[model samples]
Target: MEDKIMPTVEELKALAIEEIDKRKEEIIGHAKHILNNPEVGFTEFKTSKYVSEIFSKLGIEHDANLALTGLKGNIDCGGGEGPNVSVIGELDSLRIFEHPIHDLTTGAAHACGHHCQIGSMIGSIIGLIVPEVKNNLSGSIIPIAVPAEEFIDVEQRMLLREEGKIEFMGGKQEFIKLGVFDDVDMAMMCHTSATNTTFGVGGTSNAHIVKYVEFTGQAAHAGGSPHMGINALNAAMIALTGINANRETFLDTDTVRVHGILTRGGQAVSSIPSQVTLEWRVRSGSNEAVVANSKKVDRCFQAGAMAVGAKVSVTNIPGYMPRLDNPQLQELFLQNAGHLTTKDDIDIIDNSHNGGGSTDMGDLSQIMPTLHPYVGGGDGVGHSETYLIHDYEKAVIQPAKAMACVVIDLLSNNAAKAKEIKEKHNYNMTASQYLNFQRSVAEVIEYAPEG
Candidate 1:
């Protein structure tokens, strides 16, 4: 009689990588298609449909429209009895009108390299779903398409909130509120970066609060009888000046970032502006600093309204928490990434190294073991017009293979790696506590000085 031999974890990973490599063209093509047809957050109908069609073709069981434009698909491992691991992709684009490939009408652009995220995510799914790989793993894998990670479109998102479409502006935040991450035990995702370095891990991000500001005043003729009207645009300009004036107070160690844009300055040039709107963001390294800076920014808004006798409304929306990457999970990613590149190409920063940006993934990391690493394939500045993917293979295939192998490592051996991680992780907060804290951040303050 012939003896039966079980496949080793490395053999299973090799099988998955081979499968992913086989479909490289298709994966890269899909990413390019997404790059050409960009859509903004919460309005990714066509993009959602495209992702759903691909999921259907892959024969994966998926639920769509969880948070308006988000989608989740699941594949259970035959080995069974282990944690559920999630591979996530962002499905929205930034509004970069000046980008060369930006939509002519909508101005949506993939300047942040999110299109590659979907490609790498799908590529990882393709790799892990190979029958040979699935049969050997002991847990499930979830490939999810998430929405609105950029945190733009503040006015429109606030409208969505009023209509009860979502409780939070960020996709992951809303996903948490909707119980989308409830079943998932651990998560990992790779973001495309302009860095020529092959891979990066072990860094933190800023915590932040979102603000929607509106200044209202009386409208009158711009060229004629201008004295009869109050200028809301002037009030907004004063508010912005006040904000700038407080910049010196920000501590260098705190890494405070306060920025905003005037989304709507006026109705028409012929008329005095009656209302002006702004989308503001306040971010800092620590949560306490974020709270303090947010209060100072609010006072600046009030100062603007008081200076101009305009009624100002500031709506504070809860933003992301500082990112806390699981050390164990990051090591797994690093090990997998090492297979494709030399150690010199990878940069492993300190856990306290703040990237000076914010992400809702940070919010998820507060409650679960999550990994948000960076991979190279892109050049030019992120969120800028010049940003473009220069190497699809590095941006897509390598990360996909790495993520797949990481999953195999975690789920193999009856998911010993995942179990160890879960047992050792000391979560910062529970879902209920996170929700209460976010809700407490929500408030609408109206400041109208008495005459």
Candidate 2:
């Protein structure tokens, strides 16, 4: 379609700089629309449809509702010369009772700014859709408007899995199971952040956290023989206490964090809780280290259960993977970002954000050389009700340009970078193996009926 798209490294940077500035209003407006209509996880029906419509208008071919609510759109702009890379943008929100822009359909808000992610991705995709850019290709640029990144309603998803509705616990993982990412090369994505880093910022490598620790125990009237009941609430509290006591064991650089809440402690305040589900998360510098710490954290639950004489189930559902920085991808992003910002002062977070939060992009990284950087959003805390667009135009525009710059460079740069990235991060997953991994996580988390 486009004259065998292959733009030089320099050309890629220049193209993004010139066009990104031009499309400023268009991209920001698109982001605002999505922001205004925040959709919850796995139910972004209208959002998916709207994204599909965008693809249709641009003449880009895409498939939607992958892994429940994920959307995948691809434009073969690299002219079959280099690696095929996917640009992922998560499209779900989590502010159920928080945020000014809340969606009534799902009682959710795009507090995490996932809505903005898809918008920036669309802007980047639009920039690549130019005839000259597409024809001068070096690799494939596929934009994925993915869903269910929040990992909400875990038990509901577990039931879905039991009924054979979905294979993976999360959207990206399900896409992986459906052979969605089995194709070409590298992938790039970004998030709206509050880290005070402007323009471009790369935080500490994130961990692939397994996100659960549930508890169950016998119930007895608190006023009448409380000792007779194996208090599940007590078990959960014991787990929390153990984790807090062990916090000092975590290395400073490792940045170990473990915290959770008790869901379903008991209906009546006077009753000893029959069951409690501890929604917990553990994050660290590396997935392996995080997993190791997660295991130790699990021991706390185990000890708590033992202390309370109640059975406990611990499930480690896949969360975000340890976000790694690829010298290859980072250089490309920096070079592109440098078109607007200087290289010497290109701010990069060496110590990663240990902000006690997690994401699903970690799974995508295990499969490819993915870059999930932070672009600015208005200066309010994410996941809070007060989060608002401080400066919509600048906040949305810079991120959009940064993403477009990366896509152009990846799609137009020589085949070397793309090829190496694909080979290096190629998903080493077998369907059976992935299924087993899911089952193993389930086994660790499955709650047993009261005995």
Candidate 3:
């Protein structure tokens, strides 16, 4: 038998893009279906099933029910042995009760445009799965649908935690602990954004810590024995005040963000409030700043308990690390994006641009080469009711094409580019080190006033 000749990288990319365009309608339809039937993190049973069905129809092999309602599929290139690249899509939606498209029963809505991510990921798979494209590449592609990227529904997630269903609050963190990414060498995922009119590359996100707080006090009759009970609701309010008071101390460069919501206020109107719970978050530009701000927030909680003569318990949960974008991956994405859109429409952000948001992709970046970029077809603010994807092609298909092209660039030529990235990459920590650091952040503190 004669040796077969392979196509050039550009030719492979063109073929992939054509395949994606041919399947554009189906991809867009899938995204719309997800938008109309949104599910919250770790509970995306319907979404997971939907993705699994699609994978099955495509003859792709995958592991379902990962990290609770997440899924991962593998596509072997059949070229040779090399690094495995992961194409990721988050499978959860935010809880926005007021959104017009929100699920009335669960208040879940695709307000963050995660639906588009799934679409793009599938589109990328469609492009890369052509026999010609696959045969020319030297590595594999892992298409992953991850759960709970929004980090909402803390109370329910905590309940799941207590039940031993999950250990970490964020899906990607749990995926890490479960060794889901153990075989992968690099990863890429594009997020939808309304801040730009075109695709964006390069940018860092804040590091953060999660806190679950409870204030306990005595209950008494509201009308006759109000003074006999300590006011837990009042304690919570005072804690908010304390938190606000310390905001002035937050340095501007540190990008500190301290905020939370009161989940429980009182049991009934007739009795004084005895128990109150809050879900709090502290974020900053760096890990050190996050730790410092977290301590300050914890002290504020204790201060509220001391002032109101109530007992308080604070459970600190580990959150995302700051995002670390790979330079080589960023350049590849930029080059490919430029091919699809003009320079004026695209913004190449510096590595230092702090997005003031957090993602578990940051955690993955600490241990491996990863790319977290943004694509625009969205309008209004992200994670809000007003956010909507107006251009499906730009939001989904374009990103898919760009990623497909990048895959070709990295893996088509005997995967020499991927090998180079792996060798030159200086990761911040190993997976084991990351797990240890997160575990150290988990702690419980109890406080009561001394008589």
Candidate 4:
């Protein structure tokens, strides 16, 4: 009797790509369906159910309704025990009413191409679930769908926090707190982009803090005795102006971004505004800068209250940290991507390049090896009504194939590559340290003017 031979690593990669191609239509359909029926963070009940149904159909075992609307599924390769790798997909959309495909009643829209994330995540799973592939591979695969990545609906999230439903506003932050990622040794996810490159890897994002500010004053009839009333709206305007005035103090190297929206002004035009509320954000390339700039912004709010004899209260919410990409993991992804497209089509973003955006994935990256690459398949500015996915193949199928190949390389041969990467990687913080630091960032400051 002759001994059986194992498939070469290249052969296994080809098999994975072939499997993804075979299920391309189903994968693309998932993205299209999600785009049409958009749901915003934490309130993604319908979208969650849809993803749950798809997971069930594929015979994937999962837990549902996590962090209000998150889902986590697991698949154990029949080969052996090793490391667990997670593929993440965000389950929330932005509240863009003007987007063409937005939900009519809720105005929820996938203007940021998160729908394609779900497609590609599932596409990778499809490629990896082939009987031969699973039998030959070691360890486990985790598919996680997280909610509320957009961090909008601040008041509603505060209510949830008060109710003890969630302590953190971002879905990934909540997941970290809940120990959902405890077992995962490494993780990766692909985002859709409108750039010229077919695939992009690397680049850092900003660390930020969310602010919910309230100004309180006395209300009086505007038409009759306007002098008797204090105007909260005026105070808010003064604070905004003060923030703008301090912009010159910020350094270009810090990439400081301070912006916000006024959620409420006055109830009626005939009366002075007694209460005004605002949702503001402070972002920078480093945590220290974010903290320093946040203090400056808070002082401006206090100044506004002093100028108008109104009381101001500011609630600071912990936002995302700057991204930290793993070079070894990036090289693996880049290598796999090169197999799918020409080298010219891929973009290797510098590690120091900060995009001035923020994401919770950065929080996860601080503790483990993580990859957040981008796939081009869309046109129009991100988070805008005009943003739309034009090429499903590029956005979903290609990344899926590349991710599947990378996983094959990591998990095959007793997961030697995964272990090597894990051994060599240096974590910036432990999970407990991250949680402690984020919790420390939460506080409320109030200012009242002396008469």
CA lDDT, every model vs. true structure: 0.93, 0.71, 0.92, 0.93
lDDT by residue for model 2 (51-159), tens: 8887898898888778767777777764666677777788777846756678765668877777678777877777777777677776677888887888677777678
Clashing pairs in 1: none
Q: What is the C-alpha RMSD of each candidate to the true structure, in Å?
A: 1.5, 3.7, 1.3, 0.9
> Model 1, range 292-314, lDDT digits (tens) per residue?
99999999998888887899999
Which regions of candidate 3 are displaced past 4 Å? 1-3
Instruction: Supply the global lDDT for candidate 2.
Output: 0.71
* Candidate 3 CA-lDDT value: 0.92
For residue 405, give model 2's deviation from the true position in Å: 2.5
Task: Please rank every candidate by TM-score, starting with the best.
Answer: 4, 3, 1, 2
Report the lDDT tens digits of candidate 3 across residue range 1-451.
9987667888999999999999999999989999998999999999999999999998899999988899999998978988999999999999999888999999999999999999999999999999899988988999999999998888898899999999999999999999999999999999999856679889899999999999998899999999899999888888889999999999999899998888999999999999999999999999889999999999999999889899999999999999998999999999999899899888888899898999999999999999988999999888888999999988899999999998888887889999999999989999999999999999998998777
Show model 4 residue runs off by greater than 4 Å: none
Model 1 off-target regions past 4 Å?
1-3, 221-226, 268-271
TM-score for each of the candidates: 0.97, 0.87, 0.98, 0.99
Q: lDDT per residue, candidate 4, 1-451, as tens digits?
A: 9988988888888888898898899999999999999999999998899999988988899999999999999999977999998888998999999999999999999999999999999999998888888778899989999999997999999999999999999999999999999999999999999998889998999999999999998899999988999899999999989999999999899999999899999899999999999999999999989999999999999999889899999999999999898898899999999989999999999999999999999999999999999999999999999999999999999989988888888899999999999999999989999999999999999999776
